[model samples]
Target: MIVETPQLILRPVGTNDVSALVELDSDPAVMRYVSGGAPTPRAVIEDWVVPRAVAELSSRRGGGMWVALDRSNGAFVGWFSLRAPRHGTQPELELTYRLRRAAWGRGLATEGSQTLMRVAFDAPDTGRVFASTMAVNSASRRVMEKSGMRLTALHLGDNAETDGYERGEVEYELRRSDWESARFVWAVRGSTSELTA
Candidate 1:
């Protein structure tokens, strides 16, 4: 259990996860917003997705995609992550999350995202963690906002060329300084005591 949220677990997605991944990734509703129309094929899951995810876990950097599981029944809810792109030219981390449609509206996404930021800032040396989404992905944007990340920029996605990127994409970022401030704010709220004097 790398990260334990109120209703989810962020852990390594290992070989044992193949079945669950297959089932979750096959769900039409779950992949709707992602692929825009199609389910993730098993071939993609077997030969690419899972293997690539595991490879990320092997990196020296703490950033990598993680499996998110339901705390109640231990079922696979989906996945969330803050990963540095493979190109390595940019140091920026990409924040991401995807959960089963049934898991929507439960606040699990926000809880899991906040935990990722905590882990990132807690690391020995930290930079920034940002997540981007289709401007239309209000749900994801809400999670990013709730995690204390703010909208930093808007751009036409490279691949948005196909996914209607021409419309635009939004990036939300949380810097170490900002996270530190939020921590202080939370600490203050948690510490404030009612005055009786």
Candidate 2:
């Protein structure tokens, strides 16, 4: 396990998790922002997503997708990731999360993301942590904001999955130095011990 919270367990995802992943991606709403509204097919999950996820977990030094499990019942809630962009060699990492519809409206996304950011910034050589989403994805934007990220950029792209992309996409970022400073302040204030996310 990479990290554990009062309500969730974050662990490296493996081949055995294929079924759970397929089910999650099969939901139209879950894949809305990613595929422009198309549910990911099972063959793609088995042939591409699963293998790529497993390889990334094994090779990435500071990040990978983690399966989120409910602490009480051990159900697969969803998955979260902190890693470099798919086609880039930059050291910067991107934060991402996708949960089942049943898990929406809860704070699980923020909780898991906070844990990953800690891991990211604490690694001595780590750089900035970033996250991006469609401008209309207010729920995800809130999670990034609550985790201490701020607006960094606006990227215009061709997203035909839905008309929502007409508003463009937004990126949020947090530097390691800033996060470290905040950690120091929380430590001095003795609030670190009480922090949940």
Candidate 3:
């Protein structure tokens, strides 16, 4: 495990995980909200997920987004990441997550997101983290807010695949200043893990 939380262990993505990631990404139920209901092709997963992830890890000095495993049973749950925004502005990273539909409503998204936020801010180049999702993606929106990101903007996004979803995307942001406030709140509650950056 690269990092351990109260209930999760974040492990580096290895070559052995490609099949599982392909399976996860291919779950129609899991991919519904992401790709307007179509499953991601295995070739796309290889062409996209692997090299991009290796690149992120290499550049971040080993602080790449991670594959989350269950601490209790060692189950593959999902992946969470805090990526330096490719768009150059405001020192912001992007927070992202994808979990099995079965994992929904279990607070796993919130847990993993908060952990990734810490990991992100712990790094040298990251100053803020943002999350974006379809405005209709309320569950994802809630997790973003729950992880300390605040609603910043909502704009029209032309997504050719999602039929009528073209109205736009909503974005939320969490700066290092507010992250400190969040950690303070968690500390008061007796959290065992330390918040970094």
Task: Give the best candidate by TM-score.
Answer: 2
How are the candidates ranked when ordered by lDDT, highest leading? Answer: 2, 3, 1
Candidate lDDT (C-alpha), each: 0.75, 0.83, 0.78
User: Which pairs of residues collide in candidate 3?
Assistant: 157-168
TM-score of 2: 0.92
Candidate 3 per-residue C-alpha lDDT over 65-146 given as tens digits, one digit per residue, 9 for 90 to 100: 6888888899998888766656665666788889977678888888888778877877766778888988888788898887
Candidate 1: deviation at residue 131, Å? 0.8
Off by over 4 Å in 2: 193-197
lDDT (Cα, tens digit) per residue for candidate 1, span 27-129: 7666655666467777788788778777766764567678898888988888887677777665456778888878899988888888878766665455788
The digit string of per-residue lDDT tens for model 2 on 1-197 reads 46788779999888889899988988989988888757788888789876777776676457678999998899999999877678877678888999999999889988888888887775566688999999999999999998888999998878665768978999999898788787778887777421324
Clash totals for all models, in order?
1, 0, 1
Q: What are the models' TM-scores?
A: 0.86, 0.92, 0.88
Candidate 1, superposed: residue stretches over 4 Å from native: 157-166, 191-197
Candidate 1 residue pairs in backbone clash: 160-165
Candidate 2, position 18, lDDT: 88
The TM-score ranking, best first, is: 2, 3, 1
Per-residue error (Å), model 2, residue 33? 1.5
